[model samples]
Target: MSTRPRRPRPPHPLRDRRSPWWRSAALAGALSVAVTAVSAPPAQAQLDDATRRITEAVSADRLRVHLQAFDEIATDHDGNRAAGTSGYRASVDHMVGALREAGYEPRLQTFRVPYFEVVAPATVATVADDGARTRLPSREVAAVEHSVSGEVTGRLQAVDTDGSPGDSTSGCETGDFEGFAPGSVALVQQGECSSGRKAANAEAAGASAVLVFGSGEWRHDRPARGSLEEPGAVTVPVIGLSYQAGVELLDAEEVSVTAETVSELRETYNVIADTGTGDPANTIVVGAHLDSVPEGAGINDNGSGSAAVLVIAEALADTEVENTVRFAWWGAEEIGLLGSDHYVSDLAGNDPAGLEDTAMYLNFDMMGSPNYGRFVYDGDGSGFGDHDSYDAPVGSGAIEEAFHEYFDSVGLASGETGFDGESDYVAFIEAGIPSGGLYTGDDHTMTGRDARRFDGRAGEPYDPCFHRACDDITNIEFQGLEEMSDAAAAVVLRYATSGDGVDLAPPVTGPGGDGPLMALLGVLAVGTVGLATLLMVRRRRRGPAG
Candidate 1:
């Protein structure tokens, strides 16, 4: 599929999407490890040398260069690095090129992408029976992504509400639009079915626009905004409103609204690179989504994480290890975890055995949100409870522990965030692949306690401009980037060198010494014994003087 018309790259095995939280704890005995089963770990000198080389190469300056490149890519193409655009393609190219330059053959996993964009602000103004009009702020009325452009004014008809969820599944089905006038606006309540089905039903019934409200679920993030399941298939003006706002519209006889959604079927890609020389039976999948939200440069939203992993992968090119370290830069993460989902789905369908070989999936979504907190994933189902349970695979907590130890070693206090299917690791974890990750913060307000522990501005979003035009290079926190990068490197190198909780062959001498390891070991054994005898003789002669 990647080769036919394009002939540009190898054909990537294709499949569909594979889909799949918690917080607070310390760097205590988080992960269980059997020290006896493991091979002798690299000596402290060897471990330090490996980490020092990779972390130094993966420095803040190198990270800044990547951030600058992403910013430039955004600046060169419409001020945003959103997926399916020239800017996003530039990002893929940049990441792949860097990996190739580092001596790794990177694969471009191409896929068709469905996208939605709000080119203009939508309007939602209610007209009362007495002709008094009250206008809600743009934030209060969110234009459902993928809605077509239109301006319509008519009576606001509330769809019927009944059965459980309490707020009514109003536009969920076509029958709910019964008795709805031809030019009226259908006010639907968020529930069972998707918003796309509601909008499609409303359009079929000749409704001019749609408004879907929350179903009293407070965790319903942005109760004022929601998106259709199939954006490319939607063709009407739709908006998501807060429950309160929807109630206000219920009493209105007339409602005027305008919505515009620029959507299309654009093709995109995921960049994949492997260390090419480790145990295929044991691979560590390291990844970060490379695309930004359409609103800005995305330096902090993911540039922080992206650049961190990117530089580490590059530095890892020279490091030695046993297990294969597969690095990926996913695209179109803002809309959903599409890129990573596709990668996992393809792997599951084509190379099911490969999934077993994957020891763990480590994610780094947002590493340097301006008002960042050092947050790690709740991999053992310890935080966020069953409500937001991620169903992390066995040994996932150990992955978290690796990171926990890294942070503690560096004297950085850390907190845990729910593995709530909020990022790219969703697919991997769902397929029974152990998953863990790091995130500073994003759009969520940082509490005073978090601020004190992590030392950042409280009462503000971890990234104030999370998905805004202001998320340029200036959006980064260099200190956070440095620490997180070092931590990420430490954890990656740790797992790469020693399979910890995973099954694997003995450690190789270096990056690609897999085949000749026994030979190298034999030579080293002879040399060690000879050197030891010589040193002992020399030390014996001089040691007696002491």
Candidate 2:
């Protein structure tokens, strides 16, 4: 890790509007839904003067200062903010210090993970019955997280893979491992269950090692390695092989593989800060993953999102709110969304009240990717909403609509990204919590249609420097960050000052589509109901930080 400061780089070249853009429709509908049946509505349901001030305060320059702080932390430490590393620690310290300086009480929650690293290259080799040996190309195989360190040589057995590249019940159950012998290497396909479960079955059948490969679509499928579904659950060595490499293994009668990984037990931290005002019974949880991938500083991959959140949090520090606004900077997001997942899991067991009161969980990951797209989560589940789509909770659609309205009010044409549960919002949705947020593309390449829709380079990855040493402050798109930050600020302030949507009954829709549900400013507050809220989280893990 290097601590020397690099040449100063401004986060962005272009500046977006600094003026506030609050849609009256949002104010009317948001509070109409928020106050549903609560008695005594606030004196003004309109966007308050305070709302305008805070949203206007979230300028690109303010955002730049925070990103620069992160860049300095990464530069002084190994050019990254990966969890469990000194850089990540510095990152946490910087964030906490900022919150403390801003007159907010910041808390740190600690957790441990089965940290993993690769000290040497892993290879897959095979042998024939005639004693001849063949070595596969290095690119054909990879080691997944939590894989035990070992070099095992034994008979190679191919599990049921439905004869496809990687589809169907490759290893859905124990029966898939029928006749498996101890010390033998089992080959499984990717599908149905998690990679951990597939490997677990092979290990249960006495297999010495497990080789998991991609499914039907070949290289188009997701990466071979991901954080284990259950990190400590698997005991044998597990490797991900490409389709061709896996087929070659199954074609051979014997295979000798070396899977050696260096792993350590380490503790990481999550930064928790909340507005010390508002209703404890109703909360709006806003979050952004704080750690970067180990490769680079991850300024655009996340620094952009985190920067916006930090500035917005500081801006709202002294604001009044009817509902508690809780902000969280998650750690170890790259490792498996473990930080946010732990918070939710721990909350479920420790303080059900907190989890229950959560009105919504809004995620902002990579919102300023160089080749940005204004993607709101598919809370309405239209794209991936049906039988095969992500199971988003009930109120998610409303959250999505709120973001869309804000974007529309600003003359921005926003598109939808399906809620595949790929970010901190995953746990929220699983608890049947409604969730929505913003995401610019990551390594996914922008397409022709994408260029037309977002006006970015179609052939390049959303963020060209994604997960690389180049994702420093120089990588951010100032305009993207500016607009997204404003939207973030607006939504936060709106929800913070409104009645709890969960505590109050659902607002009755007006006769027309998207019409106001209540009288114009200063309407009657609705009655109260049993309070409950929304949440979500999703990730395979392994990012500079998730």
Candidate 3:
């Protein structure tokens, strides 16, 4: 990855915030729940100052920079910011600029990903039974860049590749895929295997061509003529098929599919900026990905997350937080967790010495959406009182506790969910860094049950228009956006100013990760049994009988 100099863009036209608004009965209900929790007790006095600073950190003007950048990159952006694209480089430049304006300087971290484009005349099921061919559209049927290539005309072999591990060989572990031999087209299922590995295995078995089915939905979904850059190299044209189509080819003899990769050396950049505030060692990182998909402006997919972080950074810029804060706008998150992966891998692999001082990683992904659910991945599950609805991560104790405090204080009927490999948080989690953050639900369908569970609209997708062009500014719910913003702001504030939340001293290095339990330990030691002695002493002193 390369770093880009910040490029200034003209200001975006302002939008009106006081426009007339209408609220639905459902939203009214949700808002009632949101407001109900406001009477909760305040955070400990030790945290008041920090919370005030963080609350003030995320400002409306700061949010504007994010909205502008999101609009520019998603709508007016040159193209998809895949790992090695120029559009990606421009996005990075913008990130670096925003971070500098906010007050923390981040270093450039880079790593490589196989960038596969297109090349060759692609044919899908062109020669099937009785030479009856059903050709598909060019764009719909293409190969992933990392797969082996070859030409063969023989009986098409079908394998049930369901439940197999991604990049694992167990599904193909048995025979030499007997029915799917060299000179034949092998058809495999999608789940349990990665596109890259499935293609690689077929190519290795001397199979001339490969067609992977869409796990279950469609038999022969499409010929997998896209990027097939698997671990080990085997050059074979691979195709993806719908589950139905792959089944149709089971008995077909002498079938052929051809695909190729258009290799290009493109450039993608990571942006770096500095608050020039505190030391780099005791750092606070707040981040969101900056790229959009090729289809529509990914406003909600990430614009929500990106926008919130931007606002938070601006709010905290001139303020003083104990530890320095760094904000990163990662690129190429959709394809894989590319940007953050590159940054961390390069650090741990190349310079392990620098890892000790890095304190915390905070992520903000989908914060703004018409229908959103506020969730925190319990980093350590320590403070998860009897509320069984939430699940926390093993080490996210400090962060998770802070979020719960915010939620409890706000009286939001919040729940915790397990961590899935769907965002940039993975990079930090894998590195054992204490990480935690908030995310509104995505892509998952929202049902009436969800509505009753979470105080929001029922019978719709959490983000009805997730990952599509329809994910524009108008798609989000203002109430949900405000709640998320406030909650995150609170956590950021608490972490920045005081307490172990921002304390970079590794738990082990200081008093052991046992600080939170100390007060409880003291209570159990004397509070429970000391009351009787105190009462007796008071009665004796008062000479009650006399």
Candidate 4:
């Protein structure tokens, strides 16, 4: 949720492009056949008996109990469980009590997070060369997150902004302000880099204030909500403007900007518990964020995920396991993945061995959207191309296969979602730890084809109340909760019991190939006989085309 400013959704790797209708239809038919052929034995049949029992013991009824508790906590503490609030403290106490009742000692990993709140609405206006002043509407100007508090009036100077699509290098470098006046206001466009960097450069260039506007593609009408990434990053007041507002002011002779905010560092914590019965060197980290945005109760945004992880942890408390299972409830995730980032950073710096000992991380976030789709992370980069900064860890593809196998064996149509660095899993993946997870979709709209595949409504957001005040207990879709939780439990137990085939070495090319469909079939055929039968069926199906 903190990946970017609040506006119309950006171009996501999953939803931005559409496949041809015919291709989608053909793929659906093929998936149906594959599911029918593989669903007979059921995916749990492949798991060890103990793993199957633990996964089955994960009851939706139990999960609902946890969700109800979270809802009540939010209600009692100001309608939210956001970090740096009494609601978050109460939520932490609740989790600690639950873990203690289940016979485990949970520890708190505390850290400081940058916090910023607008104390008053911001103001922006333009001045003509002839001394005429025109004020912009409040809706068109917003304070950038973590911006310093101040007011300034000065001549407006455009810093390399051309108002052209894809021309995002504006104000990225100090050289962009080569001839800028010392006390002038610098107007920059959002693109190619972070707002914090642009603001930092502008401040270094002697600008009294900074104004960042949206790219024409998004936030056209409303102010583009931007962030400075952390508090104290820049001294000058910074504000965001809508594309139309910025374009209108591009040629103005002067501008005035005012932003009043309280920005500082606040303390928060992550709840961590370890199942002390397995191999510590090959620990399986299972986690979900526990804090919500300030606007809502966040029952579906993350309460569902936290509840599922909690229930699974309780169910597996007494069960024997091969790898240690560490369950984490991350804090301050809604603000920018602060909790998980701090945890990973501390481990990497203080306990390098422990960081390396982490075999894999399994994340569960937003798993119960009302108009849901079963979306597994594209760990193999088969659906979404590999990210330049963070490539999926070597064994991530195997994790992807495990989930697909579980869903397919149960005859469920699952889709792949990109690892877009929007959640806690970003930390684990960036640390070179193999990671994968599930999401039930968020603010993105469900396509008509997806609606047919998942039996949900089209043209509507997966969760209409996402990040809003209405995301209480009523926002959850119980069916999505049940299905996603079961899959989560199964996959967690699978890795905890055995790390076979998920080695950290580079992936080996195989005869079964690495195509998505072929890789899925390879997982389905866990035994020699199953593989032979699948190969024969594949040959027969391709004979006509050949």
Q: Rate the local accuracy (lDDT) of all candidates.
A: 0.72, 0.72, 0.56, 0.79
Off by over 4 Å in 3: 1-57, 78-81, 100-107, 117-122, 125-198, 201-208, 213-232, 250-267, 272-274, 382-395, 408-413, 447-454, 499-546
- Compared with the true structure, what per-residue lDDT tens digits does model 4 show for residues 1-546? 542211211112211101121123223333443333442233344344665677677887888898999999999988999998888899999999999999899999999888777889989888777767788988989999999899898989999987775548898888899998889999999888888899999999999999988888865878877788888999999999888888888878898788899888989999999996888989999999999998989999799999999999999899778889999999999987989999999999999999989999999999889999888887777656444324778778777766765665455667777777888999899899998988888887888767776788999988889899999999999888888998898888777876442353433344444343533344364554444444433333221110
Candidate 2 residue-wise lDDT, 316-392, digit = tens:
88887898888999988877788999999998999998889888888888878888877777776655576334767
For candidate 1, write residues 1-546 as lDDT tens digits. 000010011111110001000011111111213232222222222235566577677788989988999989999999988888889999888887888888999999998788877778888898777777778766667787677778888988888853124546678777887888887888888877788888888888988888887776663335445667665566668888877677656677888888776777788999889996778788899999999887788888788888998898888887667889999889888877899999999999999889778888999988877787777787656554365557787778667656655554344567777777778988998888888888777776777767677777778877778778998988888988888888788888878887444532222234343322333333344444433332332222221110
Give the lowest summed-lDDT range of ten residues in model 1. Answer: 15-24
Find the candidate with the highest lDDT and give its number: 4
Over 1-546, each residue of candidate 3 has an lDDT whose tens digit, in order, gives 111111111111211111011011112222332322223122222134555456555554455456656566655554344456655665566666766655666556565555655456556654755677766555445565554344455667665544232322423443637565667677776654466666666767776777765544332445433345432355666666555555555666667676665454344544444344565666666777766665556666676777787677767677666666667777777767787787778779877755655577788777776676666765554324234323333447557556655554434545454455567778887777778887777766655544654566776667776677676666666567666776787776655665443553322211454432332343244443333332222222221110
Q: Could you list the CA RMSD of all candidates, in the order they appear? A: 12.7, 11.4, 12.7, 8.4
Candidate 1 Cα outliers beyond 4 Å, as residue runs: 1-47, 123-142, 151-166, 180-194, 208-224, 239-258, 382-387, 445-461, 499-546
Summed over model 2, clashes come to 34
Ranking by lDDT: 4, 2, 1, 3
Candidate 4: 10-residue stretch with minimal lDDT: 13-22
Which of the numbered candidates is closest to the native, going by highest TM-score? 4
